[model samples]
Structure formats: structure tokens, C-alpha cells
Target: MNESSVKPSEQLSRTLAAGSPLIYVVTWEEERLEQMLARASQELFGDDRPVWQWTAALGFTSGPGADRQLLDPVEALSFVVSESVDAICLMKDLPALFESRPALVRALRDVYDHLSVRPGSMVVSHPSINIPPGLSKEVYLLELPLPDADELRGMLGSLNSGFGEEQRVSDEWLDRVSYATQGLSSNETRDLFHQLVSEKIVDVDAALAEINLAKAQLLMKENCLEVITKKYDIDKIGGLSKLKSWVISRQKLFTKEAQAARIDVPAGILMMGVSGCGKSLAAKTIPSVWGLPLIRLDMNKIMSGGWGAPEVAWERAIRAAENAAPVVLWIDEIENSFGFLNDSATSGNMTIFSSFLTWMQEKPANVFVAATANRIEILPPEMIRKGRFDQLFFVDLPEAPARIDILRIHILGQGGDPEEFDLNHLAKVMNGWTAAEIEQMVRAARIDAFTDGREITYDDLIHNIYRIVPLSKTMSEQLNALRIWSHNRATKAH
Candidate 1:
């Protein structure tokens, strides 16, 4: 099934209408899920088929036994079975009880049996999926996705209409604000919009920045995925003409017209080659070029078990990245992270590896993955294959021309005039230098000139060029092997 094309509400309504005796919805947005359930209930079963909500704090909040104190899980299931009304019962705070209370599990199974043949359905909602073995077969899982752009846009419009014209933002700003709130829940989105209106911060740039800041904070709580705030312009990066052109050509695919035409979104490219050769910089630049948010996945954290088991933590991180759709997910030094894909891989590592391959192949179109690797030889063949990544480009050591471009950029960036230096001569002298090395050379030269109380001169840069040794010389054997590997396997980025 094309999960991306189908709306969550439609999926829920279908499941409920198909007489799924018990449904397990995994999501943190209980309020939003309830709203969807209420609407789905009315449409699927008419006004008479009421929607009931139950929580440990307020059992039977809305239903036949309004405000009834059936805090016990077994008792709650008993009440639902005894009532047996044609209704939708939303049971919150019940997943955690499955393991500790076997009686509650058996009771839920009974409720399932009772509701299977009837018009009623029991929905268990929780922030995560944790079904005990006994009731696994009886539960149908449905994950509630984060709010999409259209939904968020409608929400922004609804909130904006409540304010005076003087405080209102333009439709363009509304679109931007909606995109900015991609990863937030409905309640959080509403609260953010409320804050914006209350504070009268209707300026487009400032409001969007505030929204992104809030989103980054919330997403960071997951511990594995980080929202990258530092922006890099694609134009700032030197050379890689082919890769840059390819990226630019696909920018149209993200446009409204391209979406209307139903063009496939680019899966993303894999950049494999020397370290410090601008692979990571290219990953950071893509989001800025496309006007999308950038998220970095910390593989080390996933393996650390700080969030949970590696598999569980991986799922959480992937879900968070997908939630922030129309975003770039940068996975840097992927080979080092998934090194277990080698013969030494454990059963757990193999599971994660297989799952990652499948996810890369089938991930949502909006979640563009810009992954970089310093050791492509360590990665399994299946990972770098065609379908997994749209293209694999080898980022080699900067050629003389690219070295000159890198030098010029870093020079201008450091408040020095590139024209003052003999770039071609410097590029030659720093032969085989990585982009990162060149950047450092320029920085060191600027410091030298500053200490000497003069503007940066060509001699300042020349002095550092002789002082620093490039990675191409230090790791010549590895660099040669990488070049040979990419000759027949990947396209050249330069």
C-alpha cells in the first residue's frame, strides 16, 4: 500500500468500518487522534454510535457511563463488554498494563471477541506500540502520522482569521509557517500560532524562525535526530559541477507544478570518498538550496541504547525524520556507523541493516537522505545499489581548479580579498589538498597576517601551505584504493 498517499483519518475510518475488534494506535497526539476518531465515528456509524474516551484519570469521560470511575483495566473492559453499545471506545493508558496485569490482557481479549461480531470497536492509544504476546494476534496496529503541510496550512488559516487584518500575515507567510510547523502536533501547532498572534510577531522571517526553533527543541527530545540550524548555500561550495547541476535540476520536482504532474521525488545521492572533501558540506547545502529543514541522524546515539534498544531507537529516529517531511536527513560517515554490516555482524546488527535497506528503498519521497561515507568499502553492496540510493558520487580530493575555488571561497569568507592572492599558484602548491584542508590553510594564513599587523598577503597563505600536509599525502594508499573503487562503481562529483 502507498501509505504516503493515504490520509491517517481515512486509514482509521477504514479499519473501524471493517470491524477490527481491537485497534492499537501508536502516537503521542492523543487529542488529535481523538478528534479524528470522533469525526470517523459520526461518519461511519451515525450520531447514535457515540464515541467514548477512557483514561486512568477520568474513566468513561464521554459515553453511556459518563464520569464512571472504572480506573481498573479489567473493569473498564468488563464495562465495555457489558454495555456492548455500537460505539467507538478510545482507551488510553492501557498498553502499559498488558504485561503487569495478565488479567487485564485476558479481559481485553474477551472484549475483542465480544466486539468482533458486533458494530462496536475498542481502540487502544499509546505513545508506543507494546502489545503482549497473548493479545498480539487480536490487535491491529495503526500509527497516526504527524500533521502534513495541508493540514497545518488550514490550521494557520483558521488561526489567522480570528485576528484583525493589521495583525494578519500574507498567504505566502501562511504557507511558510505551515511548512515550519511540519513536525509539531496539532495542539503544539495551535499553541505556537496562538503565541505568534498574542505576541504580534507577524513578521514573516521572525515568525518562521521562532517556529523552527520550537520544532528543533521538540525533535531533539528524541536524542538521535538533530535539527541542523547552520545553513550552507550550495553556491558556496566549489566545483562538483555534475552533482550541483543534478541537484538544481531536481529542485523543480519539489515545486507545486511538479507535484501536480505527479513526478517522483528524488531519492537522494550517496557521496562516498575522502574525508574532509566537502561531502558533509554538500549534504548540509541541499536543504538550504531546496528551502527545506535539515536533520542530522546521530548513529552513535542510536547504538548507545540511551533512547532504548538500537532497533527501537532507530525506528523512533526514522519516524521523527519522516515527520519532518520535505526535509533533508544527513547521515554522515555512514560506513563507520553501520560497520557491523561486515562478516562480524551480530543478529541484532543484521536486523538493523536489513531494516535500514528496506526503509531507504521505501521511505517517503519528502524525506531526502543525503548520506556520506569515508569508507565505502566497509559498506555492503546492497546499501550502495541503485534502488537504495538514486546515485553514488565519489567526492575525490579537489583538483587544481576546485582547489582554487575552495581557496577563493575561504579567503573571501575570512574577510580577505581572494584577488590579492595568486590563487592558481597557491592551488598548484597545495596540490591534492582536501577542501577542508584548504579552508584551514586560509584560516591559519589570516591569523598569521593578523599577528603581523597587516592585511592577509599571498606570502601568508604560502607559508601555511608549506606548513600543513594534505590528507592525500598522509593517507595516500587509502585515497588511491577509494579512487580505484569509485572508477567503475560511482560517478565523479568533481
Candidate 2:
């Protein structure tokens, strides 16, 4: 089994047996971690060992003179050293003290040495990993992941048991609720459940919408990942038959049959090429096609340092995406994030880029990455290499047939009949126009017709086509270079 799949208690047991004096658990779910630590202490010590917890607000919690409130950082470390032995010490606020208190850092190192000889262990639980350089080697960092489906189902079951028989939902409801709440922490999930129950919102669809809204609010708090509630039907998208076919073929990868056959889930696909050619549209449509929730990773937010350091932000975003697995992660304009792939790149950029590449290559199978890039040239070769992405699809300007499909879709979308207009002639005339440009032309013509109190006519479309200059005509040289570069490198998405 993968390390990520390992249970927290099991991971703790293994880490403890490795003789790691200090363990740093990175998570927001302190209650959940404490419960796991309690179980781990029992298994390790062959009895119920007192798990002492220390906080800045409430000093040393459960020991002799525990009520005395040993509030000082130095005093707390001294307590762990002199008093707490053959037990687990959980320091809730110690990570924050490292930067301001060098003496506390030195004391922790001494405690590390002392714990190596003793059976007791010190565990630091914080939401973020911020170890001082001096104690980095001595600290074992363990990130506690969010609740998975099984755990969520168990929570749902527990909650359901409290409801009246008439109010209780089916097992199917439990499964759906569990799947919907994948990315939430145990506490968050429990709170959401209570809110839903109080509101009497038991219907699966209604509950899912509430869950998604809650999740969106929680995940986007950092501005890294946004839950994409807007879904596009794959069939409504014009052209990209090959890409659509590829998607159809992989739809079964998530099924039990595929698992039974030992088939590997697809890593993801990289859609790169011309602008306004449905790359973003395709990214949005994929989750709908596969029947999964979609979340977009804002590379801009990750690198902006508005939330925190870019590297830390990226890790948190990736973790959030993984926690919400069996879902699609859309990274639009991916090249912007790793544009500093050249030698002049800063160490921070290099670290973020390397981390991105590593995650893409070895990401959890359930998380399908749909990355779109307009300028593939700026992206590193390693990023676009074969194994990093399942396939590289070049989405160029729509061909005549595809243009007709796009025109029809947009015309129908604008409440215009395609048969009334000369679609073949229109498609022929808009030879180099992209799907977006075509849609825009259709929209402009509809607006003109609506203003004139008449139905949208072919002449109106033709008139707007002349008024708007397509990217193909203006950026001819760039388009040619992109076509030539992708001709041999990527499979055609048309």
C-alpha cells in the first residue's frame, strides 16, 4: 500500500518504532490527531499512557501541578524533560515559539536527546510545518490527511443513528454524502452534518449542494483552489472528437472492473496550443463527462505569496486537491506557474516547479489533472514529457467541420436556427477563426438582430465576422510556430 493510504495510527506506530524522538504532525484537526495518538500510545506502551497536551493559553495540561499553568515555553520544555517520562507529550504551540525563542529550540534539542533514551516521545501538532533549521533533522514531519470516504461514511452512520427512523436516510444516501464530503476535515464534516440535520436537509442532491458550497468556502479561504460549480456538458462542446474519444475510453478506469483487472487510472492530459480553441471549455466539461466534482487550482494564487510562501501554498493546495480525490483538478494557463523554468529561475520558483513536476508524475490516481497551456514553449520539457501527462493534446483552430458544429451550437444557443443560415458558406468564410471567436461572432450577430427587432440573419453574422479580427489573422506568425512545433510533438485535439 502507498504511504498516503497508511492509517494515521499505523504511521504513528511505525514512526515511533523508528526511535524518532520528536514528531511534528501538520494538520488543523487537533482533536482527531489526539485521538489517534491516544490509540498509538496504548499500542506502543502496552497500557494507557497519559498524553499530556500543552497550549499557549492553557499551559501544561495533565500532570502533577497541572493546574499551576506552566505558561513559559522554557518552563514547559523543562517539565517535559524533568517530569513527563514514559508518556506522550503533545505541544500545541511549540512550533510558533521556535523563531522567537532560541533557548526553547536548544531545550527542545536537549529534550530530543533525552527522549531517545526514554520511552516517552514529544509530538508537535501544528497546522503548518515551520521547523527551525537547528532541529530540522531531529523532527519527523507527518502530515495528517483529511478524512477519506470510509471514514466519512462512518461519521454519517454515527450521525444517522441519532436520527428518528422516519428521518434516517438509506445506505445509498450515506455513501453519496461520504463521497461528497471527501475534502473536509472530520470536525468540518461533523459540523456540516449537524447543520444539515438541524436544517432538515436530508435529500441527497440538496445535501450535496450544501456540502459543495461549504467545501468551496473552506477550500477557497486560501485563494488556492476554487470549487467549479459551473458544469459544461461534453456533448455541447464542438469538435475535439479525438480528445472526447480518449475521455470516453478512460471513463471505465474508475470502475471496480478496472480495479479487478489491475488497470492503472490515467495520470492526466495536457491540452496545449492556440488560444480561444476550447481548451478551457474542455477542462470544464471533463468532470461533467466523468460525473465528478471539479476544482480549479489558481497558479496565480499559489505564486502570489498572498496566502503564504509559494512552496507552502502549493503543498497545501495539492494536499487539498488530493483530499478531494476522485475529482478533476483544472489548472488553466499552467505555463504561467512554471514560466521561470530557465537557468535564471529563483530558488523558490525552482522548488515550486520541481514540486509540481513530482506531484504530476506521482499524484494519486483518483485525482485527474486537466492542465491547459497557451504557450507550451515556455513550459519545461520535463513537464510535457510522456509520463508526466498521459497524453499531450494540441488544440488548434477549428477545422471547417468543427467550425460548422461550433456555429450550430452557438446559433442554437442564441435561439437561432442553423438550417436557415448558409452554415457551409459561413464555415468556409471563417476558415482560421477559433471556437471562441465563432461563438463571439454569433453572439454579436444575435445582439444586432435583437436590437433591430429581427431574427439573427446570415448577413449579420458575416458583418460581425468582418468587424472582429480573429487571433489567427493577427498572430499568424505565432500560430504557425505553434502548429509547426505541435505537429510532431502532440496528438491533434481537433
Candidate 3:
């Protein structure tokens, strides 16, 4: 889109002049915002620049003397109302103080009302929305999204101007950088681009990767979302043809081509089953399958802090996930995270869970949430709603055939002769064992062989199985409860 097409400031000015006063702009880039305000000022007053300055060092003084005075938000707001400063008064970093200082919110509202009747205008700019309840009616909130492709291209062109051989950079690389930095600030983009060049990995793809890493860090801090860059393809994982096929069927829906064709991307999937099932593996491997990075939301980090703190963390986490779009967000042990949703004492937790459910219900198609849970009973009904998750599949312990596949995969990975192993006999003997337990038994057999200075044999596996107890045995009641619940609600993993 062209710069002319995205004139948010012009829209804001028009709104204010049309009698809907008090524009509140939420944006991360203070510098870009100032440029927008300057453009708006030029649009408002021809030839004469509208005086604007922010900072408490110099108080607000308009016209000839106004250019030098820097004032706090309250003081600037007061000056705008009292002195009738025709200029648009811009305030930065004021949202952090709005909630704490009721008086300031009241003052801004008062100034807004004063400007509503007069010719003057005031604009509040911050990276977040913090309008006080009292000022909600007076303030009009607007989001200044990150610069679009054209704006980013213009920035790159300006940055490269008058530079010699050192300024060498490919248009494709710049385009990739622009595409990667969908929610990043101008400074973040510059820092990331230079970091790539400084590290001498200036190739287009590498530069895009570097930019992505920076974005991951910022989004991680914002949302308590852990960006998992470790590679795990379907090939790394053994066969799960059914599950793999399910994922492949909707893969095209996530692409730009699919979006252009007016197809809605699938919301997400919920994988529930017994412990040691390949649910977790499927969650991790999805990023590789979709060619997107994986992000694991750390509930431990999210749960820390006093009352009402989790709300901030939750919002930040969701924002982070949204920012890292066209990616997989894995919430392992999702049961534990929302376990308290039904309890009255966990109002905060419930609030957090509700927020998450709402996000999951309405999240952009690009954000594929792979949430896994062992205890489905603890999960709230809202989470399993059709719109929240496209499909809910039960990932029970591998059946006879899947177990055989799992065994072959494990044995081949360890250089064992699958032909010599009695796959049918082993499957029958390990009826209730999970894929994890089977793997453990295999490892135990290997250990026995190494300890005895002999080759691992079927006898070693049988001996190990005798010594180990599976989840179906130890947590029989819970396993039975889950199985019964899944009878009508979930798709059984064969």
C-alpha cells in the first residue's frame, strides 16, 4: 500500500475537526509517530509549522517562545487549554502514568473538552492503551500499526542514500526484512538489519532469519511465549500417517495464495491422549511441517506476580503470539495451565483462561495453536468449542500397528535388526504401555547388554517390561475416566 493510502493522521484530524475530539494513538515507535504528527500539523496549517515538543525539561510555551519549552504531559495539556495553543500538543510515554495519576487523566479530559469547543487540538501518543475510565468517553483510541511494505521500502531507500560500496544490499533481502518485521518498530528493524551485516551473515535469507530472531526476542518478552527454533521435521519423527495427513490437508490454507483465494485458514488443533503418546512430538514437529518457527508459552513465567498481574502477562503473551504470525504456538500440558478455570478462588486464572479462550476463538488464521493436554476433564468446555479448535483428537498409546511402526523406528535409529525382533509378540506383551514406556524398555535392554558386555535381545526387553509399570496400571482410574470421556467427544488416534 502507498503512503497516501494509509493516512491515519489525516483520518484522526478529520475526526477531531468533525467535532469528535481527543485522538489517542497507541504506537511503539515514538519517532515515526512524531513524523506523523508533523505531517498532520503541516496538513492543518499551511506554511506555518504547528509547534510540538515533549519532555519535562522545558515547560509548554507556544509560538516563538513555545519551540524551546519542554513540559510534562499534564503541563503541556494545561498549556494547550489555557493558552489556546493552535498547535497539536503531542505527549509521549504518558500512558504508564495515566492509571496511577487520576488527576492527570481528569486534566487531559478537561483539556479535551476545552479543545472540543475551541480551535486547538491535543494528541496523546503511547505504545499501549491506558485511557482511564473517567476519560474513556473523552478519548478516542487509534492503533498505529507497524509501517507497511511501501513505507519500509522508503525507509531503506533513505537509509541507503549517498552511501558507496558499503551500502550494498539486495532488494529481495530488503523485501524479506520488511515482510518479517510486521509488528516491529523502525529502530528494531534497523538494529536487526545492522546486526546481520555486522555478523557478516548479510545474505538475504540469513538476514531475514536474524531479523526474525530479534522479533522473537521482543515478542517473547512481551507475551511470555518461548520461541523454539530447534528443528524437528516429520522425518525426524517416526510415522503418524493419519496425524500427518490431517496437518497436510490444511497446510495450503495458511499460505498467502489460499488467503488470496478467500479461504479461511483452520483455527488450530487439540491433541489429547495418554502420556508418552506422540502428541508432544506432533506439536514440536508442526513448525517444521509448516515451515514456521515454534513458540512454547511458558505458564510458569506467566503465572508469576501479584493479583491482577497475570492479566498483563496474558495480554502480552497473546500479543506476542499474534505478532509472530504464520507460526505455531505450542502450549504443552495445557491442562495444568487452565486447571483452575472452574474454581472461584482462581478468578485471576479464570480471567486469564477466558482471555485465552477468547483469543483462540478469534485469532488470525496464521496463528496455529497446538495445545496438548493429558487430563481432559480439567479443561474447560469453552476451550474445546468447535470455533476455538478445528479438531480435537485423542492421542492414545500406540495401537498394535502404530506400536510396530514405533518399534521399528526406535530399533532402526539404534542400529537394531527389526527383522530379528518379534514385533507381533512384543505388541501383545506391551498392550497398555505407552510409546514412551516402550522406548524406555528398549533403552533398558540396551543398558543391560552394555553392562553385561553382550548384545541386546528380546529376552532383555521382556525382563525390563516385567520390572516396569505403565500409566494404565498406576493411574488406571484416571486413564479409564479419560477414555470414557473421549468416547463421544474426540477423534481416537489409532
Candidate 4:
């Protein structure tokens, strides 16, 4: 069955209607979920089944028999079991309290066991909860998703006053605004809207800037993904014309029009080649040209075991990256992270690998992956399969034309006139050097001229080229092996 046929609210109603006694809903937005749950309750439990809530801060504030304060976890569970009425009861933030009182955990399970005879439903809500093994079987886990575009638009539309064009915003403009605020909570969107409104003037451009900042902060708070604040312009990288052309052609994949046409978004590309051959630079800068946020994901950091196990952190990172949609997830030195995927002995590594592979396969289209690898053998066969990623490109050593382009780009970038230097001679001599190596040559050559207190000369560039040993010479065997592997398996990047 297609999952998109049913909305989240409808699914919640069905779960409760099917007599799932103890539902554990996960979300950070308490108020929003509570209202949604109330709607769900009325549909399943009828108008007379009073929906109530209890919390540590405000105990028994929203229900009947509101005589006493049940601030303790033990008392809350006792209240749920003791109250013999057809009323839905929700307990907020119960895990920590239950952690301290093991008796409450057992009591909760017992409550779940007998809740079927009571003719009511009990729900436990929290941002994230660790379900004890005792009650794991008794609880139905449901994650409350973030508000979608339609909900966000309704909230923003109410606050919008004379901001859009002709006193009415275009649908395209509204959609972009909606997409920009995709990852935010209802409360967060409300706060941002009010903040924008307090200036007493409305501007779509100004509002979008604030929304992007808020959305980025929402992703960063997860601690798994880091936002690339600085621009890595795709046009700055020289050479690799084939790869650049492929990337440029697919720029419209992220647009609303593409969505309307049901165009499949580009999954991603694996850039494998010599260490300094613009592979990493291409991965970093492609998002800029695509007009998407670039987020660097640290695989090791997620697996470091401080927050939780590697699998747990890995899932969070994937979800967090998806939440920041229209994003480029740059995984650098990917072989180091997934080398163990082929081993039967390394179970932990295999688990992380499996989780990542599933996410990449099933993830939302808005999250584009740009993974870079230097060692091809270490990558698992499953990782290179067509469905896992859109394509894999080999970033080979720069040819003469590519080298000249690299030389002139870096030379101009460093404020030296490419016209003043013998770029042809420099490019010819820089045979077998990668783009990174050529860039370093340009940099080093400038320093030589800087020490002499004058502009860099063509001879200075030639002089610097002799002092450096390119990666091709140092790792010739490895480079050759990579080239052989990519011959029939991957497309040529340059």
C-alpha cells in the first residue's frame, strides 16, 4: 500500500481506533502534538470521552476530577489505573521520572496490560524516550512529524500584511517561503513570523533570510550536521568540464516546477579519484551552484559513542539532514567511514553501514548526497550499485587543457594576472599534477615573488613547480589501480 494515501492525523486516529492502549508519541513540539492528539481522540473516543493531560509542572490541569496535584510519576500512573472512566489521559515527559522510579516503569506496564478493560486510552509524550525492555512490547511508538508546507502557509498567511507583490504574494513566492520554513516547528514559525512582523513592515526577501537562519539553527541543534556558512562557488573550481556540465544541467531538480512535473531529483554522485583532483572541491561547491545548503556530516563523530551507540546517532544524522531539505550532505573521506561494511567480523560497523545505505536509498529527494572517496577498493559493492547513488564519477589527473584552466583560475583568484604569467608553459610542465597540486603551485609561486617584494613572474611559477612532488609520483600504483577500477564501472569526470 502507498504510505502517502493517509495523512499523519488520519493514521493517528486509526492507531487509537484499533485499540492500541498505550501510545508513545515522539516530538519536541508538545502543544502541537497535544492538539493533534485531541482531534484524534474525539474521532475515536467520541465527544464524551474527555481528553486530559498531566505534566510535572502542571499536574492534572486539563482533566476532570481535578482535585489534587499528581506531580509524582508514581501518582500519575496510579491515577491513570485508578480512574475508572472513559477518558483519554496523556502524561508529558514521563521517561526521566520513570527512570528514577523503577516501580513506575512496572506500574506503567501493568497499566497498559489492564487498560483494555478500562474503555480509555493512555498516551505518553516526550521529545525522545528510552522505553524500558519491560514495557517495550506494550507501547506503540509513533513519531509526530514536523508541520508540512500547507500548515506553515496558513500560519504565515494570517500574519502577512502587505508584504507580497501587488498586496498579494505569488504562489511561487509563497511556495519558496514554505519550502524555506519546511524544517521548522509550528511554534518556531510563529515566533519567526511575529519577529518579522514587529518591524511593522513586510518584505518577502527579508522574511526569507530570517526563515533560512532559523531553519539552519534548527538543523545545527541536532549536533550531527554542521552548516557550511561560507560560499564554495561551483564556478571557482577549474577543469572537470564533464562533471561540471552534468551538475549544471540538473539545477532545476530542486524547483517546485520539477515537483509538479514529478521529475525524479538527482540522488547524488560519488567523486573518486586522486586526492587533490578537485573531487572534494566539486562536492563542496555543487550545492552553491544548485542553491542548496551544504551540510558536512561527520561519520566518526556520530559513531564516537558519547551520545548513544553509532546506529542511533547515524539515524539521527540522516533524519536531521533530511529535515534540512534542499541540502547537500557532504561525506568526505567516505572510505574511512565505510571500509568495514564488507567485513563480517565488524558487526558494529556493518550495522552503521546498513542504516546509512537504507537511508540513502529511501531518503526524501530534497536531501542530496555528495560523497567523496580516494580509495575505491574499500567501498562496498552495495554502495556503488546504481540505485544507491545516481552515478559515480572518476576525477582523474588534470590534462593539459584542464591544467591551464586550473592555473588561470587559481592565478586570477589570488589577484595575479594570468596574462602576466606564461600559463601555457606552466600548464605543460604541470603534467600529471592534480587540480589541488596546481593550485598549491600557484600559491607557493606567489610567496616566492612576495618575499622578493614584487609581482609573481612566470619563472617564479616554474621555480615553485620543481620544489613540489605531485601525488601521482608518490602514489602511482594506487592511482593506476583506481583508474583501472573506474574504466568500466564509473563515468569519467573530466
Per-residue lDDT over 1-494 for candidate 1, one digit per residue giving the tens place of the 0 to 100 score: 79768899899998998999999999999988888899989987777555898887778888986767788878888998998688999999999777778798889899999997898789999998898888889999998888887888887898889888888878877877786677788889999988987898878667866776776777778789989987788989987877888888787575444654779988888998999988999989887677677889998888878889999999989988887676788999887777543455666667787888999988988789999998898888898888988999999988888988898889999999988888888888888888999999889989998998988988888888889988888899999999888898999999
Poorest 10 consecutive residues of model 2 by lDDT? 336-345
Q: Against the hidden true structure, what lDDT does model 1 obtain?
A: 0.85
- Tens digits of per-residue lDDT for model 4, 1-494: 56565666777778788887899988888888777778877877668455778888878877764677777777777877777667678888787676677897788887787787766778888888778888888999988888877677776676564455445555555666766677778898778766755663246555665665676677777776777756677778778889999999998787656766889998888998788888888998887676667788887777777658878888888888877776789998787776543453266777888887888888888788999988876787998899988989999998998888889898887778998877787887888998888888889988888999998888888888999999889999989998888899988988
Candidates 1 and 2, the one with greater TM-score: 1
For each candidate, what is the lDDT?
Answer: 0.85, 0.84, 0.72, 0.79
Question: Which residue runs does candidate 4 get wrong by more than 4 Å?
Answer: 1-5, 18-20, 41-50, 65-68, 73-87, 102-120, 132-138, 161-170, 193-216, 219-224, 302-309, 340-347
Q: What is the per-residue lDDT of model 2 for residues 237-324, given as tens digits with 9 covering 90 to 100?
A: 8899999899887876754345447789888899999999999999898876665678998877777799899999999889878876
Worst 10 residues of 1 by lDDT: 339-348
**Residue-level lDDT tens digits of model 3 in 3-78:** 5465565666665456555778888777787777677666776546654555444554345336645456666666
Q: List RMSD in Å for every model shown.
A: 3.3, 4.1, 4.9, 3.8
Clash counts for the predictions, in order: 0, 0, 4, 0
The candidate maximizing lDDT is 1
lDDT of residue 298 for candidate 4: 85
For residue 474, model 4's alpha carbon misses the true position, in angstroms, by 3.8
The list of candidate 3 runs beyond 4 A from truth reads: 1-13, 16-21, 46-51, 57-86, 93-120, 128-137, 145-177, 197-212, 219-224, 255-262, 298-313, 340-353, 377-382, 411-432, 449-466, 472-488
